[model samples]
Every structure is written in structure tokens, then in C-alpha cells.
Target: MHIELSRNSSVKLYLQIAKTLADRIQSGLLPQGTKLPSVRHLSSLLSVSPVTVSKAYAELESIHLVVCTQGKGCYVAEPSVSLHREEALDLSWQMSLIDYLPRAQLWRNFNHSRQVPYSFHIAAVQPELLPTREIINDTRRLSSEDPDAMAVYGTFEGDVELREVCAVHLSERGIRTEAEHLLVTSGAQQGIDLVARTFVGPGDVVYMEAPTYTGAIDVFTSRGAKVVMIPMDEQGMRMDILTRLRDTHPPKLIYTIPTFHNPTGITLTTVRRMQLLDLAQSYHCLIVEDDPFSDLYYKTKPPLPIKAHDLSGHVIYIKSFSKTVAPGCRIACVVATGSVLDRLVAAKSTTDLGSPLLTQKALLPFIRHRLDNHLVSLRDQMQDRLTTALHTLQRFAPAEVTWQAPEGGLNIWIKLPPAVDIAELGRLADREGISFLPGGVCYAGGMESNHIRISFSYTAKDTLEAGLRKLCRLLGELLDRSVIMERRPIL
Candidate 1:
């Protein structure tokens, strides 16, 4: 039996063989109760270890795809029952979404990818890092003291007290805003959607850094806006290209993640931050400054958000606590001075009435009291993981592959050799039981690129060490194979 195996995958050899054999059984290529090859015979035929073949057979047995007799060899099993019927099901939506559906599908695929076990693609904080005890305390205290806050519908803009807390928080970060200007959003993604819906429309040009957040891209494109990609460097979004695009496109909004940028983990220089604000003002374009990872900085502290220097209220600043404080809190505050704030509030009304009152109320005390202490410890733990990941890469990665060391932020951006295919690498990684955010998913157009984002924030330190080594080994093997293939004579 010739069983094809993925040499570059992170998945173990036995599981791959098991899945392949199972597929053959399902397809009726292998009849029910058909005698299968002995472990020694299969191993010899496939050029794999007998132990691997035995494990594969064992896996098939566990899945009930095969049954082993006490004295005889393994045999294919009868088809088992399933909960649902297998049929072609497709939704015929009212709207013509031919152009838009691909984006939705890509977003859905990326989201589904996160469910894989031991996923390194997840950028959110680990569950162990969350302040569960503190939240429980806050919930109990709030339920006793402010039952009305929990039961009754809260204000549309958000609780005045929480808004006040957010305002003070924003002020500390150099974003000068009052409770009146602050609007509580469900999350940073919703905030981006609100801004996109309120301000953007069909054919309205939106400028963003090439490898920006996927949520921002979805918001812009789903609204039928033209998203123009701006290039980036170590300092952050390229101001030269931005100015030229501003002149060419006359963009309605410039969406940016200026601090601890996603995927790349680059921070905008203070000078560039100031310059970006100036460009936003001069071009009369709104800057959606999504600042989530700023607080997670492990190296040099980043400069203030563009909203901090918003002399004309052109910048909409959103600071999300979900990534750092709590994953399900879904609480982020938006700072917009006048019309932006009012429109966002109106948009909030349209998009699910408002964020749950209980979530807001429960988080208020935690934010007020426990956040600073939690962050101190959280930052230290993340720093250790970051150090471990880097050390692992140094020890295992191919000399040809280079990763730019990020000062802060959850991800390390790896620049692959130009000839390498990211999709192939991604499949290999997934097969090997590791998942990662391919750099293309970070861009506006979902164009495959030579960069890969490895996050150290989501997994355990031990998991990170092993996962990084596996990833590096996969890259090394792939790079070597590509070199060999390049030199081999083609028929």
C-alpha cells in the first residue's frame, strides 16, 4: 500500500496515515471487513517505521474504522452511523454577495482555525492569565450593591461611572477625552464596524497599513468601501506612501494600529505619530486608532495614540480590555469628541441595542482596582514566554529564515524566503498540530505574502518551546526541499 504523507506537516505520522486509511474506507475503496496489511508489511511497503504503522492501525481501531482480531491482522470496519445526514447544503441569500462572500469565508475559516487544539494562532491572552477570582468578587459585590445595574437596561452610551473611568484611563494614555465623548463599545471590532458604517460608504477610499487587522478589513470591505493598502516599515506605516495615497485617493478614513501593531508588532515613532496626526488633519481624513496592544508592551513604551494628538477631533481612539484584562469581557471604550461619538452611540443602538449591562458592571470594579497589579504579573509572564520563543527560534530555525524581534506585542513576524509558499507552510504546520496566523490574513486583500506571525501570548511556555522548535524544523526542511527542487532537472 502506497500511503502519501506530508513530510513538512506538524501532524504526527501515525495520525496522517490513520486519516488517509479512514478516508479510503469511507470512499468504499476499501471494503468493509477487508483484511488490511500487517504492521510490518505496511511499514516496509510505505518505507515508515513499524511502530508508526502499528500506531496508525491502533488509531483506526480507536475510531472504529478498523477492527483487529486476536490472532489475525487488522480489517476495515462497517460504516458507522452519524448524527446528521450528508448532503450539499448552501444558503441562497437575498443579497448578491459574489464579491463579498470570499471575504466572509476567509474570515470564517480564520476564526474556525482558532478552535484547533494547541493553536498558536490565537492572539488573545491565556485563560490562566485572566483574573477569575477578581471577577467573581466584582460580580458578587456588584450584584449585592447594584442589582438594578444588573437587571435594568443601562444607558446607551454606557454607564456614566464606567465612562468616567475610561476617560481617566484615556487621559493617562494622552488621549484627552471626557465622559461625554466616550462611547462604550462591545469590543474593538464593533468599534471599527461602527466607525466604518457611520463614516464610510460605497467607493469611499479607506487607507490602512498593508498587514493590518483582519476585522478592520472586513468592516471596510463589507461596507463596499475601497480599501487602499499602505506599506509599512519598522517605524510603522510608511508616511511617504501614505501622503501619496492621501493625494491620489483622498481617503475618507485611515485605519491604523499604531502601537504594538498586530502581526508585525511594530510601534510608530513619536515623530511619525505626530506626523500621522498632521496628515489626518491636513487630508481631512478620520483616523481610527485601534490601540489594544499598547498596554502589553514588554520593551520600550510606545508613544501616545494618534487620538492623543488630535487637535481637531479627527481621530477616533479605541482601547480594548478584552485582549489584556479579560477575554469575554467584550468591553472597550471609544474616545470621539463630537459627531463621531454621537454617531457611534446611534450605531450602537442599531447593532444589538448595547453591550450587556452585566458585563460592563462586572468589569468596572476589576478595571478600577485589579488591572494594574494583574498587568504587572501578566507582562512578566509574557516576557518570559517571548524570551523562550526567541531562544527556541535561535536554536532550531534555518539560518536562511529571519524573524524581526519585536520590542513588544504578542507576535513575532517571520520573513520567509521569497520562493517559499506560505499556504504550503501553513498546511504543514497544521498537519504537525500547530496553527499560526499566516501574514496574508493580516493584509487588506488577503494576498499571500512571505511573512508569518507566531504568537507567544496564547499558549503555555512549555507548549511554546516545543511548538517553536517544530515550526523551525518544518521551515528548515521546506527550505531545503525547495533548494533541492530548484536545482533538480525538470522533464
Candidate 2:
């Protein structure tokens, strides 16, 4: 129902109104048979005359985009196109096909084809920051040493040597685990999907932080699990609210990104980490701790993952190297204990037999020898980019615009005034060769449109600064126009 109209435009008012409604209808934003607001209601909403609204509705009816009922309001019309003889096969039966998996908004946003000159939507370290040559050398060594072994299928649980190396790597973060307790996954996303497949089911309750990782949301929802979002503050997911929600809808699992959380870039405090584990243990629910950005901290290390304190085998820790290292390699591991670990292995076997052994072996040498220095270099470079982003935002952004300075993580979440039209701002940004993540797509329940997430680690510092400046200028223009519209006299 949120619509933007320009009174100063050359387009006719009624035609503009019809076009907006037509766009929404065609895009499935306004589904078929949806009842539109009454002419009076829409007129009041748009601050236009009822006659203008009527003309818009009539325009839509003439084009067969909407069907008017005798007493009821206008409704979106179903497709009435006549099929040509060459393509006359009736495929309408496919319309009734089951949609076990609803739309994944994040995937749609990320996979968009429009190439922007300055993109901040990707949440990964810059390619230049990754250890490329060393990885290539490692792959070459592995292929040369054992081409036959690399070509063969690995054990369902994954390469023992890679898992062993990962175990040692995790020990530095205070998570005590052996190679046998880990299950190698294609990536952190695969780890999440495996866990959801192994446990979550239709109508099962899954708790998540609002504005959490979009991939996690899609994974859980695909399993038909009821994803309930817990609101977050600077400290992370509000524990008090979580406790209350658990009493009402006991969850099968709780998903969290404790360190350098995606979208928001907030880390959960140590106390909360322990508190979350305790609640999970008490409630007899498992916690899926996704830790992709934990190693990318700007200064001090983040609190040890919830798995560190998980004495009762309640935490399933997923560690990803895709973002920090070469994303093309796509190597990550899932750490769980007992039955949970067994189930994940079983599920992974059915998923892909095992992750590509070649990639795992290719990444092994880098992890054993060069990982620490590589991470340190990445942290420093990301920190510099973060500083540049903050400086540019301060210099160009309006006073009304605000954001929290995250200590770590690739993204900075910015809040715009509620009155400003984010869709319009996005359109303008796209035209200016800029792109960012709109906040509404991050949520599971309450759709928030006044916030946006931009990554500092993707673009070069100078390009990042320039893109952010352009974004801020476009936002300022939208804000100014919104004020003018609000003060415009009622027609």
C-alpha cells in the first residue's frame, strides 16, 4: 500500500496511479483476486481526488488488469491471454504444484542480474584480501601428489586430515573438539541446510534473531518450520523475550550468529552466550551457532563460541572459511556431539556423498601453515575499510541518518527516517550504479523498510566511499521530497 507519486511530473496523475498498481499486480506483489482499497480510501491515502482514483481503476479495468465487482472493491484479475497454436499446451495444472519452500527473498536479491558499478550487497572480504596464490599452490601440490585420491569420493564425514586440521584451528578459539566430532560441509550454508533437514520439520518452531542471516531463514522455512524472530538490541538477541517466547512455542532449534552477525554486525555478549546455552539445555532444544565472521574481528577477539561452554551437547557450531578464504573453495565444518553429529553425517551423505575432496585437500595446506597470518592481514584491511566507510558516512550523510559502528563484521546497518521511501531510494541508487541491502528482506515477521545494510569489505576503500556518498545524496533527496509531499495541500 506504500506508494510514491510525484505532483511535479509530466505524467498524468491517473496514469501514474494505474501504472504503479499495474506494476505491483504484474510482479505478484498484489496477488490475483486481491481486493484493492476502495476509490475513496485510495484517494485519501494518496491525497488525490476520488475522481482521479476512479479513472485509475477504470484504466486498469480497460486493460484487463483488474476486475470490478458490483459491490466489492476492485480485485486483481487473473491472466486471460489466449495461447497461440504452436504454444497451446495447457500448463495451468502446474500452478497447483506444491510450494513446500516459499520464496527466499535474500536469494532473489543477491541473484539479481542488474550489474551495479558499485555493489555493497555481497558480504565477503575483497578478493585482493584473500590468500589466492598460496591456495593455488596448495591445490597444485595436492593434485600433483595424489591425482587419483583427489578424484575419488571422500568419506561421507569428509577428509580426515582436513577435519583434524580444523579441530586444531578451533582449539585456539576455546572450542574443544576432535576430528571425529566434526562433519565437513560444502559451506556454512550447507551446514545449516543439513541441520534443518536432519531435525526441523513442518510446523516445528525455530527461534532466530530478527535481521539474522537470510540463508538461515530460507533453510528453516524450506523445511516448513515456523521461524519466530526474536528482536535484538546492541547486545544481541534479547534474552528476556527469548525466555518468554520459549514458554509459549517450544522450539526445535535456536539459530544465532553470535559474533559479527550479518546485516546488523552486532556480537552477543559472553554472558548472553552462556545464558543462551543454559536456556537451550533447560528447554531441551538445540542451538545452531553459525560462526562465519568470528575470525574477522577488528581488534579484540569475540567471546568464544557458545559451543565452548556447551557442556550438555546442545550447541551445533558451524565454522565457515568461504568468506575469509577463497569463496571458490567453499570449505566449512559442522561441530556437534553424539547423535546430532551422527545425524548430520547421515544427512550430508544423502546430500552430496561428501564435499569435494579436491577442494578440501586444496585448502588443507593453507589452513595448516598460512591461515593465521592471512586472517590477521584480512582483519587489518577490513578495519581500514570500515574506518573509511565511517568517515565518508560522517562527511556526506545527513544528520537524520544514523548507524552503529560495529567493532567487527563486513556490514554497517544504517537507519533512515521512516517517512522516506526506501524503494525509491533503491531505484535511484541503482541508476547511480550503486546497490545495497534493504532491511525489510532481513526480517522474518515485522518488515522494516527504514534500514539498509552495506558491506565495507567488498569494494575498494575509495569506491566504497564514493558509493556511500552517492547513496547518502539520493537519500537526502528522497527525504526532502517526502517533506514536500507531507506539506502539500490536500486536493
Candidate 3:
């Protein structure tokens, strides 16, 4: 009954435990109907929290390897029953037969059900925050003036006028690029996917910020690229470690969320932005700069993007309008030069022909005329919300917990005591109609289980304080439980 768990491994603790037990069961070492250790007993034996053991057992049950009774311990399922269950699902065989899917650890956990009244999980701008009237008027005008233009197919590269607008948009961000160099995408997500598809290949080396956007992790891994995570500090992704890792594993690309980073909400300093571009150029690799929150700044604007300083075309810049303008439009653009831009256009053509012409046209007027004023108002509102969230957290959060107040971005990253089990906290929070993003999914491989990300956006203003208070209470309760567990003598 010896089970080993490695804290340093990229795979999660629960998943590792479940996989080991599953292997044992499949190999006939753990026979069918064999009663497994109780959750508490196994937790003590493995030096882990009961919640971790519970999650492992639950995973085992999900794949039909084990079963648990209300009061009894988990037991391995019968071979025949397991076989029948596997046979019931057609795609189950495909998983073993072909290596087609990526290890999407993030989506498996944070599915964004939105079933809860107090959801701090979603990272998009709420409808009330968007310029709905302005966009509607623009759409109406486009329909009235040129009905046939909206109906016809746009070039796979994107609408020329929309590209022109995006070029102007990039110029404001300090990136100098023309319409010909821009590739309009369905969204920033699609832009990331296109980059992955074009440049990444099996076993190729890709580097990223340790806790980056979840979608980037999924996309690169799906392309069979080995993702090496570089840790970050207050300033942003650690440059020294990246320098060290580059000697042994020179990357094909470095994916970054430089400004107002996702999950953590930390911005890379101007010095590091230049350093990053330099490193990418030295390594002869490309940098995919994802800038989703640069415009939503609370204080002074963030430094110019990494792409802005790229004199050698080492950076591919992606800007999304989903958060700032209209989410339903799903509009974003990629700025690249030479062959890289050509390959991205080729990838986009294969993916969806092109992003919808109507949406692009509908958004063009807004981006041209109203985007600046809209962002100013949006930033003001977001800053107010951030203030309220921070005050609530400071008042109710446990003394042991620590978090850095982000200057801008939708999320607030909170670090709890290591002893507090995140699995149990999530279960409790979900039961209480609360949802937040677990920190595990943000990493490329290794995980930090004691951290959680809560977005200040997309929650109703009235319930925001209550949700923060409830979450803080839960953290306190878990810490107390961990103390009690530590004091108990081993039987």
C-alpha cells in the first residue's frame, strides 16, 4: 500500500495518485473488489490532506476503476463492469488508439458553469460594462449602407478596412505595423492557436511564464511542444532563470502575457520587456506577446509591449477587443512580419476561412471613433470595483493569507497557508454558490495548490463583498482544520 507523491512533478498530486492506483488495478496487483484505504487513513499514510486523497479516489471512481459506498471505503470495480463501461463510450477507445488530444488540465477543472450567483471565476467583461449602444448603432449603419458587403466572403487574411483599423490601434500601443502585416482572428484565443499550429511541432521546445493563460498551455501542448515554465516575481517573468534554461533547451517560441498578466495580474517592467525581446533575438526564436488587459489600466498605462521594441520581428503581438469593447464580436488581430505573418494567414485560412465579416465591419466604427472614450469610462468603473474588492479582502481575509493588489487586470491572486487544502475549499465554495479559479490550472506542468485567482469583473456589485467575506471565512476554517489535524497523534 505504499504510494509515492512528488511535490516537484509537473503533474498534480491527485492525478498522480489516481494514475498509480489505476495502473495497479489494471495490472491485477489491486484485485477487483479489493477495499482500498479509507480517505483519512490514506491521507495520514501519504502525508497529504484528506481532501487530496478524496479527490484521488473520486478520480478513480470517474474512470470506473473504483467505487465508494456512503460509509465504506473505496473498492476496485469488477473487470467485467469496467470493460462494459469503457465499451459504452466510443471515444474512450480513440483516446488509447490515437494520440490526438492535448492534456487540457485547465478546462478539466475550470469549466465556467456559471451556476453560482457569486462567480469570481470568469475573466471577461460583463455585458453591463460593454458599449452596447455604440456597437448596435455601428452595426445598424453598416447594414443600411452596404448590405451586400456583409453577406459576401471576406479574404481569409481579414477585411482590409478592419486590418487598417487594427494597424491604427497597434500604433496607439506603440507598435508600428501596417494593415498587410495584421491577421484578424476570431479572438485572441484563435490567434494563440494559429501561432501554435504554424510554428510548434512535436517535441519542439516552447517556453512560457509559469502561471500564464491556460489556453496557451493547452494550445502549445496540443501541438506536441514541450513547455518549459519560467517563474515570475513582482516585476514579471524571471529573466535569470530563463537565461539559464536557454543554454540547454533553446526554445522555438516564448509565449508571454506581459501586461496585466492573467491569473496573477502582474505587469512586466519596461526593463524586462526590452530584456525579453533581446533574449528572443539572441536565441533566434519568436515571442508571442498576448496583450489582453493593457488598455484596462487603473493607474498610469503599462510600458510599451514587447513587440514595440522588437526591431528584428522577434515578437508576434496579439490584441483582443473582447474585454474592452464587445465579447460577442469575438474580434482580435495578430501583428507579425514576413514569413511568420504569411504562415499565420495560411493557418487562419485553414481554420475558419476568416473571422465573420459582419462582426469585423460592425466593430470597425466603434474602434475608429468610440474605443478611446469607452476604455476611459470602463477603466474608471473597473478601478472602483477593484477598490471595493481589495477593501473587502483586507477586512475579512485570514491573517495567514497574502495577496498583491494588482494595478490592473480582472483577477486578484491570493495565496493561502500551504496546509489549507484547495480541493476541500473548492468543494465548500461550490456548495455555497461561490466559484474561483484554482491556481493549479495556470501552470505549465508543476502546480501550486495553495493559491486561488478571483476575478473582480463579471460579479454583481451587491454580492461582491459577501462573496469575498464567505471565501475568507472558508480559508480561516480550513487553516483551523489543518492545525487540528497536525496535533492528532498517528495511530
Candidate 4:
């Protein structure tokens, strides 16, 4: 086998060697059970040390890619048929169906390529702004001083100090919850999963906003709950639709992002908030209020969370430090009252013993002191980016496209002409080294083909400009093709 080495490559030499050999094997260049050349012989051929070859072979053997008989040399292992292929493939298809089925019928007539990266991803938090150095220092300090804390299993409700800190922080937003009322989760994603597991079950009807957070939709659908989407306008979820659904369906849970909703960055007005609470109370439905991006409001102070207005024990408020602090830290808090908190705690205990104690401790000081200052800085940065993004879009984008300037969230929702296929545009952008999430992924029934959400949080200013240019170019090509196909003369 001929092997080449790059001295400047970031991957370890042995790993590179192993991967090259593995690829060759997978491609059938090396037949199954074929004996590999001796390490010393291979080392001589490649001009690498014997130890490097040995380590590579050892790794292959450990992974069952290769095997060595006690007295014989190393040989490629016989290809093992996956025992779980049928089950695994079935599960994968099932999950895909859960995601795509609701909207599959609508998509069937569309022939657009699904391979593209839709140029706008509205759901992701800005990882570049995360306080990495502070978290690392705090983690090191906590591990050095309190090794025992790291070793033991955390309490079922999660770290007490973290919960207390969350309580104090959330109290400012009008949620009067004690530490016991809060449960620390891996992140808000897990919080949603736990809430679904605790409250919803097979065939349970759950109410969510149209053009809602896609992640929440997946969680609820995966749990076998029937989702009912209430339409949303500029002021947020239409209270009338929610009320009608609540009265007719009698949903088990109402999931909504009242402050700066996901796809459309609309905030729920105070009157609408009260109306939702009233409907939930009258219907006896549990409300799962997800407010992950409420902290980054650009224009004005956001209203207090819906939970703050919950005089009745209907709202289960879930928020995350991931958006404002760090994504990898995976720290989120869920505040619920009475029996709801109790059941969620029990559900959480089953998922993992608890969330990482070190992460919880590292975040305590940051939440107490650094978070407020961080939000102010983040708000300023986001405002500047949002302004720049809107100007660029207005200048370069076609006149047919329109979007809403969100008050404080990381992304803006753009409405493209109906004929412009976003999935096809996304595939074209992917070839140019740009990635974006399609609007179809954000809707419950796969609707939103005419819309896409653009995020200014992750992409830098220069990259954003370049990406937008490329995106517009792709959109123009798609429109031309669409128009040509529509007007084609038939024989």
C-alpha cells in the first residue's frame, strides 16, 4: 500500500494512516481476510516509525476492523452483517416519517432538490459570543476545589446552587418560583423532551403555534402526541384560534414561545398573553412556555414571560442559559408549580442521574454577575448585525422577497415568492460552501415553502455579505427556471 503523509495536517499521523487504510478496505481494494503487510515492512515502505504502524494496526484491531490471530499476522476482518440493520433502518424511517409526514403530501408535487443548504438558519444560537474562557476557568476552579462534587450523583432536581441562581434570575421576569420549583436540564431541548414525557402521552392533543419552533414539534411528535398548530400573526399566536382549538380539542398541553417566536419574530401582546392564560385555565390544559431567545431583545424590553402571569398552576416555564451564555454548557432551567415539577423531576431522574455538576457550578457566578453585562453587550452587537443584514437584504434581494425585522431574536423570517423553491435554493447554496436551514423544517405540516428564516447571530459581517450575495444569485437562478418551466410551450 502506498501512503503519503502531510507534516502540517492537524490529524495525528497514526489516525490518518488508519483512516486511509480503512477507506481502501471499504472500497474493496483490500479483500476481507487479506493479511496486511508486517508493521516493520509497512513502516519501511512508508518511511514511518515501526511504532506508528503498530499503533495504527492496534487501533484497527480494537475497532474490529482488523484482527490478529495469536501466531499469525494481522488480517482484514470479515465484513460483519449488521444484525440491527432492519430494526435500525426501520427506526430511522420512522423518525423521518415523524418529521416529514405531516407535510409530505404537500411536498410530493414539488420536484426541487432537497440537497441544498437553505441560506437562512434562524434557530441556532451564536456560539462565537459564548463566554468560553470564563467557563473553562470556572470549570477548572470547581474541579480542583470540589472534586467530590463532581464524583457524586447530583440531586434529582439538579444542583441546588444553580437552581437558586435560576430562581433569582427568573424572578426579575415575574416568575415567583423557589429553587424546588426549578429543574436543571441538559438544555432547553432536553427540557422540552422531559416535559413531553411527563405531561403528554400517546394520542394526547398538544397545541403549538403555526410556524413554531421545529425542535419542540419533533419532541412532541416523537412522544406520539397529536400536534394542533394555531396560526400566528405579527402579534404572535392568534388567541382566537387557540381558544377555538382549546374548546374543541381540549388539548393536554399548549406549547408556545410568547416572546419573539421562532420563525416569525413576533412577540405576544399583553392582552393575547392574558387570553392564552384564560383559555388554558378554562380548558384545563398545561402550558409549556419555551422562551429561549427572550433575553436578546434589540428594540424594547420584552414583556414578562407568560409564566409570570400564570396565577393558576397551568404554565411550565422553560428557559436556557445556552443562548446567552454557552451552548456546550447545556444548562437550562424549567420552572413548574406543584405536581408538574414533581413529575418532571421524576422523569428527569430517569433520563440521566443528573446534568453535569461541574457545568452547573461553573455557571453560578456567571449567572449572578456576568450575565446582565453579557446581555447588554450581546444586544448591542445583535442590533448592529441586524441593521446591517436588513440593509444588505434590501439592496441585493429581489423586490418579491419580504421579511420582518424581529425586535430581539437572532433571526429574521423572509417570505420569498411562492414560485421560488427554498429547498432547491438550499441545495444550490450547499455546493458553494454555504449552509442554511430550509423553512419547511420549521413547520409542523411542512408548510412555509414561501418562507425562510435568516440568522445574523453566527455568520460574521463579511461572511454574511458574501453568503447573502450567493443566496440571491441562487434565488434568481431558481426564479428564472421556475418562470421558464411555467411558460414552456407544449406540442
Q: Provide the clash count, candidate 3.
A: 2
Off by over 4 Å in 2: 1-93, 112-114
Between candidates 1 and 2, the lDDT winner: 2
Ranking according to TM-score, highest score first: 2, 3, 1, 4
**Colliding pairs, model 2:** none
TM-score of each: 0.79, 0.83, 0.83, 0.76
Report the alpha-carbon TM-score of model 4 versus the true structure.
0.76
Runs in model 4 lying further than 4 Å from the true structure: 1-122
Residue pairs that clash (backbone atoms under 3 angstroms), model 3: 10-445, 10-446
Report every candidate's CA lDDT. 0.79, 0.85, 0.85, 0.77
Cα displacement (Å) at residue 50, model 1: 57
Q: Which ranges in model 1 have alpha carbons more than 4 Å from their true place?
A: 1-102, 109-117
Better of 1 and 3 by TM-score: 3
Error of 3 at 169 (Å): 1.7
| RMSD of model 4 against the true structure | 16.2
lDDT of 3: 0.85
Q: lDDT by residue for model 3 over 239-339, one digit each (tens)?
A: 99999989888889999999999989999999998888888988899999999999989989899988888888889999999888888899999999989
Which has the higher TM-score value, candidate number 1 or candidate number 4?
1
Task: Give the CA lDDT, 0 to 100, for residue 178 in model 2.
Answer: 96
